[model samples]
Target: MASGQVKSAAFVLLLLNLLLYFIVTVMAVWAVNHAIVRSRKTASVLTIPARIFPIYFPVGNMATGFLVIFSLIAGIVGMATSATGYLNVTDGKIQNLHAAAASSLVTLFLTFLAMGLACKEINIGWIDANLRTLEVLVIFVSATQLFCAGAIHARVSEVATILNIYGSGRV
Candidate 1:
């Protein structure tokens, strides 16, 4: 594939990842806050359980959403700097790329955990279904981004040399 095409794909994937995570985060916050508000309306006795698994699901979703967003931002920045090869492959950018990859891994794990909790609690509610779909898409896109970023970063010079290109902008 052409370098430009790779970079373009990276940009688009990153954008989609960002948008999906943003939506998921907003929905999660809304769901969580709604529950909290409803809980506050009740005057029931405070039955504090030492191990309440229900709360962790929403919290995990919220955390995953935030991490996914961070990954998306890093991916977008790295891809956009493709034209400036050194800038794209520098320590900061590499860190960003790795951060994104790590975030994706964490998100994938958290997503499955949340889904399992949902299955146990709600038997696949509408919100859970949507979140699951979004989570899968993000996982796929982020994984692709990580693979491409690693290859591009590792052999950027080789690619340019093989193609008989000049200058750092060869990427």
Candidate 2:
């Protein structure tokens, strides 16, 4: 397969992965909100403990795990595609590779930051709220990163077109 085709496939896979990530995030947020509502509505604090344990524990763990795994996968795929692009050595391809690598690195950093914030057990009054805010920030950053990745992929396709024309001896 041609380098262009490989790049395009990688981009498509990345987009699909991003879509899945988005879905997972939305579901997790909904689950968390639902749990919060239930926690608020229940009458007995003791019974509430039992109620929350059944719902919150599983959902929160799943959500955290999913985000961590998805972020890691995205970073790895982006790096692999970038490496492939670099190997291709075409001018247009290089740009795509650079963009992919940079985006991946940024994503990796962001994910780690999010994990750190979420995992910290220290709670000094407003700390829980602070952690929640950080989580929201991570979500926003991830969405932006997804958009940038899609744009980079589109640019790669355009570059491939130009390169093909140039290779074909067309002025």
lDDT of 1 by residue, 42-151 (tens): 31434456134244233234244343344344334433333233333333244454454444445444544544443433343334554565445445544544554454
Each model's lDDT comes to 0.44, 0.48
Best by TM-score: 1
Q: lDDT score of model 1?
A: 0.44
Task: Quote model 1's TM-score.
Answer: 0.45
- After superposition on all CA atoms, what RMSD does each candidate show versus the true structure? 7.5, 11.3
The 10 consecutive residues of candidate 1 with the worst lDDT sum are 50-59
lDDT of 2 at 163: 67
